[model samples]
Target: MEVTTNTQVNERELWGGGAKPFSASYGKIMMWFFIVSDALTFTGFLVSYGFSRFKNINSWPIADEVFTHFPFLHGIDAPMYYVALMTFILIFSSVTMVLAVDAGHHMNKSKVTFYMLLTIIGGAIFVGSQAWEWKNFIKGEYGALETKGGQILQFVNLENDKRISIQDFAIGINSERKTHKSNIGLWYQNEKTLPKITVEEVKKGFLANPNLTIRTEQISENGQKTLLSRDEAIYKIDDATGVVEGANLIHNEYGNRLFADFFFFITGFHGFHVFSGVVINIIIFFNVILGTYEKRGHYEMVEKVGLYWHFVDLVWVFVFTFFYLV
Candidate 1:
């Protein structure tokens, strides 16, 4: 019967052992597997971050206020400008990768080489920019006081209702303080470097200056930090436990400690991926120059790396959305 014979042929074609599913090679299939797994991992992290932020919505740091620094534009308030530039650069690099893959398909070694180099350069710039941003974040701008209850107290000027740096108001009480090391301490505790200004000094300066008011981490109904009256500020400052100059695993001058934790983990993880991609791209760049793919009669390696680069770029879009915009 013709019908039975056609059914057998169809089964053979469908179940063939040598078949490439969806016309994809083994390498592409593996890359897709990796990308899918990685995407799930990123999703879990972002979900956790979302939940934590929701739980601490009142104390969460405002992304715009926190990430306002731009290189060579110190003391200027330019929110999200540098981050937008970084996103554009990364997306543009993805475009270059697409062109590189297309050139590889056509066996155009020169074009592939040019585009790969450009992608590498773009990736390098993004990584460098992220590092610079990290430096500024860790260094901090306006210092805050941490209470015994783990609350942050920032200072603002009543005249302009703007934040003022600790140096602007805090009176310098320079005293030599030694860092606690395991070898030097009886409790075997190791401590980080001391903050430039101490809590005692900030408290002293607060009492001396009448214009500076305390801004609590609690967000009011207007979605702004709660500004305490002069009487309340003086009452609140008495509960000061330490001076937090910047963010770390335990303390964050910005706001909630969890915000800094999620920020470092997410962005640092993404930065690692970008750095790895650049290194891989550089290797492929040399191969393109040396005609290794030409000898093999295929540039599948370039296409494979292009897939990875595209995945990295796509993940960053989600990261930028969650971390910056939201």
Candidate 2:
């Protein structure tokens, strides 16, 4: 009995290497890899923002005062309300996406289609709302004076404690104030469009109105902007070198220019993600409608897109916490 024992095994008895690792397909694994890389990118951006904010802690703008506008509620002073609503919309969309994925798992094409449509609608509303917010931020509400050192000085009525717009108090001055056109100025040094009012006009107006006072960008321990006395307000107005009407890459009437820069970049990046997720969802939605996944006997595509949608919603929660709530 020449017994080679179990050492002489047949080739067919050896383990085959055709199975997927962790039972996940290549497409699903690729999506996860992309998400992890993108998350690291967002983390870098947020860390930079946090450091900048801490360095400029005194002059940073208050989120409540900056984002007070709401759709159809002009002059309501509803701080952070609209942002909260936008967050809700995005989270709700994530829920619908979950339903869609679950329906796909069960091979229920009709339910998947219905849930995907709901998710698309929710995303559209959120994107549109974000556009409106950007418009308001750029257009600005109450204008402010920018000091020589780039500090923002807002105006408020001492009697009513309400904000006062430059348009209401600035006295029109007849002078040689002209908009700098590209033809007249240096070819490479084109000026941004001039503000509706001038610094001198604002100064003159401030001197004339005893009831109006200046609010510095510095927040007090009481969580309010530092208000100056009548005399201090008038004295500060003399240092106003320019009038800032709205937010831009160069200037932000709200407060520090860096605040606006971070706001635009971080929020814009997240918005782009949401938009991309919406497009992906729509494509998957159509495929489901056409019985493509039904013929394949699985709805893993819907599950993958669902993961992306959920990630987008999760990122917004972090953004809302750092930018708005905190």
Mark the regions of model 2 whose C-alpha exceeds 4 Å error after superposition.
1-17, 184-189
Q: How accurate is candidate 1 locally (lDDT)?
A: 0.91
User: Lowest summed lDDT over 10 consecutive residues: which window, candidate 1?
Assistant: 9-18
True lDDT of residue 65, candidate 2: 87
Please list the residue runs of candidate 1 whose C-alpha ends up more than 4 Å from where it truly belongs after superposition: 1-16, 174-190
Clashing pairs in 1: none
Best by lDDT: 1
lDDT of 1 by residue, 90-109 (tens): 99999999999999999999
Over the stretch 19-54, how does candidate 2's per-residue lDDT look in tens digits? Answer: 556667777888899889989999988989999999
Residue 67 local lDDT, model 1: 95
